[model samples]
Target: MADFSPPDDNKRTGQRGAEKSGRVADFRYRPPSQSKPQKCGTGSSAKKRGGGKTSIPSPKPQGSAPSHHHRKQAYAALDLGTNNCRLLIARPSGENFTVIDAFSRVVKLGEGLAMSGKLSDDAMDRTLGALKVCAEKLRRRNVHLARSVATEACRRAANGPAFIEHVREETGIVLDIISAEEEARLAVLGCHILLEGGEGPAVIFDIGGGSTELILVEPGGKVPRILDWQSVPWGVVSLTDTVGRCTGSRDERLARYADMRRVVSESFAPFAERIAPRAECEEEIRLLGTSGTVTTLASLHLELPHYDRREVDGLIVRSQAMRDISERLSGMSLEERSQLPCIGNDRADLVVAGCAILDSILDIWPSERLGVADRGIREGILRSLMAADAEGERHRREIRGA
Candidate 1:
């Protein structure tokens, strides 16, 4: 097994005091690109873009046994969000990890949480079914280290802990309902590599289903420092529920989109003010985004017939282009949206809300080009797990020499 050390040197995930002020601890993280993994080429490998089938990479030929080293080092990350259940299983390969298996399902776990403030029975059932499949994949892949996390839906739900217990009892998966601060940190850790090469200050954001996170970053050397971050309780699901749908005539839809943007702007006002001076001081502000909204919009920007992570991931597009797409989508009727190739029915209802949130983000940061990333928390988790294993191995070697 890889002997990576646990990331104890990293800052605490708790948010209070200084953290509450939008400032976080100076955490150190060496990205996989900066450091080589202990073992290379051990294993071989989306979005819960709903209204689609789960994607599983083709496996090795039947009856072919994976190498023992691959089995011992395989790691998995499960991200159970308000709208989706996604899993990634991989092993360290050179500077990065090679994904062996993956699964994604749109469970809509927080479907009615805005009104009910609880995980609905139906939502739970849907999510559990997804998790069952993930469990099977994990077992089949022989995952040696795994981390499962539940986001905003669980954090805000009154019955979240109980549901977590139920999931554990049913599937043997323990979920860590992380803090908003931790969520922001993990996202930055995962996708910062995609930011267009620049040393000037930058902002990276994730527009999630139940919440949106915006992080102001100070970049210099290998690891960027977190200047500030904020998590607003307005994601595609929550925001759509609050703002209502973009229904009726074109004028009405435009009004609804404007309203959504205003709401998000107000929520982001304080953070925007805090970072205003910093943005002004910097020569350039690079922007990167990791979420369904960015990835879907990127696909649209590319005019792909279907969603392709290979083409979308790490792609950069003009900020004006994204805003244009957002406005166009906001004007389209629900049925019109459902017919789009990358959107389909599952994401049609929520994509407008996402657009509104993104538009608001643009108002604040106003970067020229927006870098899109299909990777986020799960990739961050995999890197952390593998890095820890590598660190552990180095320590053991030191002990042997001593």
Candidate 2:
């Protein structure tokens, strides 16, 4: 009932990579240092440079081993979102980092947050237990530098800070409550490589448990520069909590699904309006989504017996197919949806909300295809950490030469 599953043990084969132009190749993670990166802050905010562009230096990807001096340095990134707790541990490879350990669990940390405006005790307990496991992994892996972040749920909860301090006291892991802007930037940094190659600006989104982030980026550098972004307080968990799951007649469920769409659309109105004028003129609109919602839907689109990141991540599905699947999932009853593979009892109830959110996204930015990315904030953090370390190493070399 806790919704906790064992760690993945790197079974996913995190074959993520990036190109010099910030596009995907054989699933890699290209470090931001490969390009001239402007100085930017980390932990709580995104790095914004001149020309109204937000820079999220791509983190180092996982690849070949580094020199002997760099072999011992292991970095970790933990993303504790509203619905899940995920951790990634890796070491800097030649130009990227190789994943050594990873863990993901559906803890639903924001289970009752919408109604209570606070993190419920049960949810906190569940998350803490999962974090304990993450702490153990970090210890066993001997992670040299680690950054753990708590997103929307923690940011919205009144007792979020208290819970964060408690987590440090209990697990010795410091969790930074990052801004929605930073969250959006990090999500893009993690998965932008998967975006379909194109000329015009693209939209990358992360549908979290408590909040959904949509970012518009102009891609031409090592990392795409954010043109505009918005974080709506309507993710799978929050939206589901606000809109009852209409478990009655099929018509009733469809109506509620419409209601969910309406709410999300209105919330996204400002963002939609801002991008419409610019996006409408572009020859082709490129859209990429990184979150459980997109991944789950991608899995269903593939008709796989179970979830597989290798296939889902960096995959593209027809926008119309995604829309049709979202509508279908929205109409299904909780039990009916639960029976479907890739969306069992765990995601049955909340998947509908996700569908609604995705529907709204497709409506605003109508694209021929939607790119799916299983990697996000955690991978972004890993890249940033490795880039910083590489920079520090360069500084040491310069001092030694001087």
Candidate 3:
């Protein structure tokens, strides 16, 4: 089995100004535009910047349209990650953008990639099905300019390229397999705005399905300057699948959880060394997390009856509280974890590994509080495309003036 079910579409509802939906929201700030963006140096790579388009008609949320111009200029971003497939459609509104329609589904694309070193057939089918839904949503929304991406799972899979072609042929959507560096960058682009006001260096991380990215950034820059990044080969899906089953008493389960943490902690040692000097003057430093593990944990921390993106995003929970939750969760059996509100049966087995990973991260960088963000690669991709669009518009205006 693929480990996840079909997602219930989060329909936009009645709200006057800037309302947020489930697992998606209107961010408080947009990433500052880059004065100069380093190019990938190849023509093929250059063309990937906002290169695809496929738009169709779709439903809209209740409320007055922000602007006719906003509707006329629509952009879309699709992110097929190791565990979840997500889509975001938005239009420029003032300095930022408003999400018009969005979709997210857990496909568990890397369910067994850790040991197998390849995407399983069931996982591929699940992912492709979710992508098809994204295609339809994009079409219905008439998304003109769009960028679709696949992350760690596709990068390491044996038949990743073939699967990309298959997705295109079947869903009329193209998926770009991005590098680890780009993946970390996009994640930062999408989520860095969630960082609380601080001048000290920051650590932003995304705990994914097959890998976890730990990025060190120097704050106070337009887009936080990515000083260094490390992609550890341990995500929730890969970690859980590799950790074996937890079928014993609470002590045994906690021991297994501890083992997972040890493995992740060892992986962080090298990264920790590189940043050891920076840890000296840690005043005003911040730690922000973007991933299912963090968000799910945030929901658990809040004890929300169901997941709420608006409430969770930008939320600050104390480090001790997060640890408490992880500790409490580790003591529970898989069945107990599955009964959790946001976790359910589909995510029950996977959440423990996630908690373990989170524990390891806290061990490395002990911040007072962790910022939660429901946004990531998709949000990052949208910012890139919209920024490119704004630049193109300026260029055209200059040409006309001349």
Candidate 4:
């Protein structure tokens, strides 16, 4: 299946004034202007300056919408990773959801942390600022329930708890630094809908800015049992920084890509070996990829002059096509890549590193076609929240009836 792209028809309605309590009241705010949030420390100063003056409107609660009498309950999820801080608010409609509003910003929370093993002051400031914005959005939407998580950057940082406290104080958002196991599970959950009909075991890989997560699943099972999982410390941002300093010729660049492939393969070897035997003999062994790399490749394969979520999500790219795209990306200079519609200036430099990581996963799995998923941790968090709420409601009704 192709990557998943939630429709963008969710419109904002309601008032835009501060409540009598001096807090932003219930309002339906629109999605942030950028598709992905800016990474921390990079352009945060400008954003902070501009964000201060930006208008934040409010939205009516679900049941209050006049036209939609049977309005579905709303839920919200937030994911703060090494590189990005994202939030999604949605209203469930049957099995799916209509995203009411979404926000994403690249905070690069893990920036320089790989080398220093600590979250920098500037990075924390940037991330906190973004979180503050998210908190306001949640308040405006009156998000009844939400879950916010921090990933590798926080997990590895020495002052992670202190950082979380700062977030709570500044944004009124609690940040949970999830374990690697939970990270793998959430990744699989995000991709579960796409793997419904796949044969044999399906492998899902997510290459993030600070880490990579791989989850192997046997299809058609109650909660696809995780066959094997692994989290590699290296991600696009770190790998690119390492490679950029090497100073190589064209041949060296290719060689560096090869080296990257080897590094990832080595990290994934044990898990890959366990799954490879089954994958080879099975007809349904397939790869499902989530993250910026695979999506960018899908966009490039479609020859999109610009990044279009509708065109790239759930689109299948053959192994050869993947290679072709990787090679084309490797050959381009940062300036050249920045010009590509799918790879903007912000991602142009890191895209190749992401491609390298992806190539390694593909090489290890050797799947005929890769399934794409745009959803990830945020979706998983939302699903969990909704389910918990339903369970709670059911319990309350049962007690009342009794």
Candidate 5:
């Protein structure tokens, strides 16, 4: 394995905390870049604007393999983040890994962390139960190489270290608390392949439950060089906590959402100065987003009956249309947003916070098209492990030849 650790430090899966606005970086700005979503999608199938790519789909449910294959070894990646615990079990194929099984559950581990620096007992219990499921899956799969990680919530909570100890005792799974820089690197590793074909710089973002990561990359070959990356401490859960749930009338609700956006935009100010000029570079500036926020918006844009990763993954939506949906959702009361088919009570409040964050990104990047990805750290971890497995094989072959 390529030591999943970066030169410094770093660390999602399908299914994916709590910090205030001023912690990550303290800066603010209102740039004039005309940030807007140029296209949006609506239909029975996934949305496809002109120039975008969907991710490689998970193997079919009936997918199977011979047990005697020498080169194929199953690997597992478990991601325990602020809002979700997710597991991915996969085997290396030619260029990609085929998933054998996957598990995801919303644990809301950082639900109130923005207000309280400690992880609440209830949240810890919820996350522990989810981890138990993940641990069982990894053990049964007999994973060859596994890397489990805990993100922002674990990085911020006062009881985070204690919780990590408890998780190992209860589930026998060890989690590494990664740094913000590493978080941005893995996210780019996982999704930069989907960036629109262009010589200009592209922005890839992962809107996590407790924080948001934005990476600016200048496309080289297949991998993107991390030109500059920023991690803002405001995700769906944390943002909602910072800017209270929309509890008043329609106008009041919109006002609250606006307040949330302001907070997020302030955090992006420092980065905005560096990234804003790239919009006019004339190379091919595009934006790729991987997070629950993008996935949900892609679903609403597609008007699907329910959330479908197959359809939503890699879908490109109009920046304007996404903002429109966010605007409408922000105007609705929590009860009304919850009633929507895709977003129920549990996600009702958080979705609006996600919208605020997305809007801020759109304002900063202003890409006509937005790419939505259903994969992140989990896929990145699997990719890295598979690469090492292949490298080891080649090295052994060379030794025999020598």
Candidate 6:
């Protein structure tokens, strides 16, 4: 594994902030772009849109037996969300998957969409650029089967279908606009690997750029029974836009955080009620959090002065440590936060809002320790594809034997 360091600079000039703000503002009211029609589902079209060459270089030859034989073939998954676009290419190794290639960029695909009910041109362009890179990587890896999904932003946007059409036309990547229920299910599937040989009921929460998903499960089952789940619209970006404008004193910011927490708690009330019926009798309830917010917090708790996925992933953080980290972050200005190795200029301002949302979720659930998960939707998609492939292989073998 390679060492990961935070970006060197965190200071954003007022001008830069204004520029980003302007982009956001433009997305809020601008009309969709009128471009040439795209041909859907052709491999050649995808290759052209992604660029002439592949994004990831081919793997080097090994001295002995080919690792490709011992290890299962590579599988790919892409998740395009309201705030970020990400790709993961991996192969199954026994019970878990080893990542062969991965890419992620924050594009804010849903930026200002809440107000306009449509994806802004600037946001669409940024998202498309990220997808192009992902497509190239997939091609380079020679990934035979993969699934790409788009969440909240596309689901909410009035022009989302057009946007999807454009993506197929340009990238040849069909973006499945997943429903909230499906989103929750995929999150649980990705986190299931973490539950192996563990005890008690577990609660999984995934906080994304646009929405938050919560799931409750009990032991004694191969798959965790979904006791209850909820998808809350309040996320880091949305909350920050609401709470960032009310800055005054430290006390005021604290009050604002409290207000944000109240709102999240209220949104989670129905789910809370559904779980409360069984939660009391269940022994040893555990909390698991999957998203950038939790991972960033884990990095800060380690005080590494850099972000290393290996160290942060699957680590456990105590409630007090989480609280301390949140307080430290709240005290720092956006520029100061940008300087932190775990948080860079891209996430400085938005991270505080994420922290607030996580804190609220913690208060509602009140678990002592939280299991941090770097994997989420992409992993879930890969697992589903792999399972289908395995089943197909089994059927073929059975037919041959017969």
TM-score per candidate, chains pooled: 0.83, 0.84, 0.82, 0.80, 0.83, 0.80
What digit string (tens of lDDT, one per residue) describes model 4 on residues 1-402? 122111111211111221111111122223333334334323220001111111111222222222232336566888898888899888766545567888999888877776676788888888888888888878788777777888878887777777876666555687778766677777776556655255566778888887788777666644466666777766786666544522246666666666666666666676677667777874756777889888788777777787766665556657678878888777676777788887887787788888888888887778877766677778777666655555556566568779
Task: Please give the ranking of all candidate structures by lDDT, highest first, separated by commas.
Answer: 2, 1, 5, 3, 6, 4
Best by TM-score: 2
- Give each model's whole-structure lDDT: 0.76, 0.77, 0.72, 0.67, 0.73, 0.68
Could you tell me which 10 consecutive residues in candidate 1 have the lowest summed lDDT? 39-48
Candidate with top lDDT is: 2
Q: What would you estimate as the lDDT of candidate 1?
A: 0.76
Report how far residue 101 has shifted in candidate 1, in Å: 0.6
Alpha-carbon RMSD, candidate 3 = 13.0
lDDT of 1 at 258: 87
Better of 5 and 6 by TM-score: 5
**RMSD of candidates 1 onward, in order:** 12.2, 11.8, 13.0, 12.9, 13.4, 13.3
lDDT per residue, candidate 6, 1-402, as tens digits?
122111112221111011101000000111223566753321220001111112212222222222345346778888998889999888766555677899999998877765666788888888888888887787788776778888877877778888888887676677788877677777777765554245666788889877787777655544466655667776776666544522556777666666666666766777677667445656666788889998898888777778876676667768668877887777676667789988898888778777777887776677777777777787777767666555556566568779
Q: lDDT, candidate 1, residue 283? A: 83
Tell me which of candidates 2 and 3 scores higher on lDDT: 2
Off by over 4 Å in 3: 1-71
lDDT of 3 by residue, 306-394 (tens): 98876777787787898888888888988888888888987788888888888887877777778887788887887777665555565
The parts of candidate 2 lying over 4 Å away from their true place are 1-67
Residue 182, candidate 6: Cα error in Å is 1.3
Q: What's the lDDT for residue 296 in model 5?
A: 87
Clashes of 1: 10
- lDDT score, candidate 3, position 35: 49
Tens digit of per-residue lDDT, candidate 5, span 1-402: 011111112222110112211111101111112444211110013355322222232222112222336437777778788898888888766455678889999999998888888788888888888888887787777777777778899898878887876776566677878777667766776676666676677889999989899887777855676677778888888888767888888888877887888888877787787778887787767899989888888888888889877777768777888999999899998888888877887789899989999999989898888888888878776666555555555666668779
Please give, for residues 1-402, the per-residue lDDT of candidate 2 as tens digits.
Answer: 122111111111111121223221111221123344321210111111111112223454333333477755888899999999999888766555678889999999989888877888778888888998998898888778888888988888878898887777666788888877778767887888888888966889999998888888888877887777877888898888887775899988998888888888877888888889767974788899999999899889888899987778778878899898998988888899999999998999999999999999998999888888888888888787777666666676668879
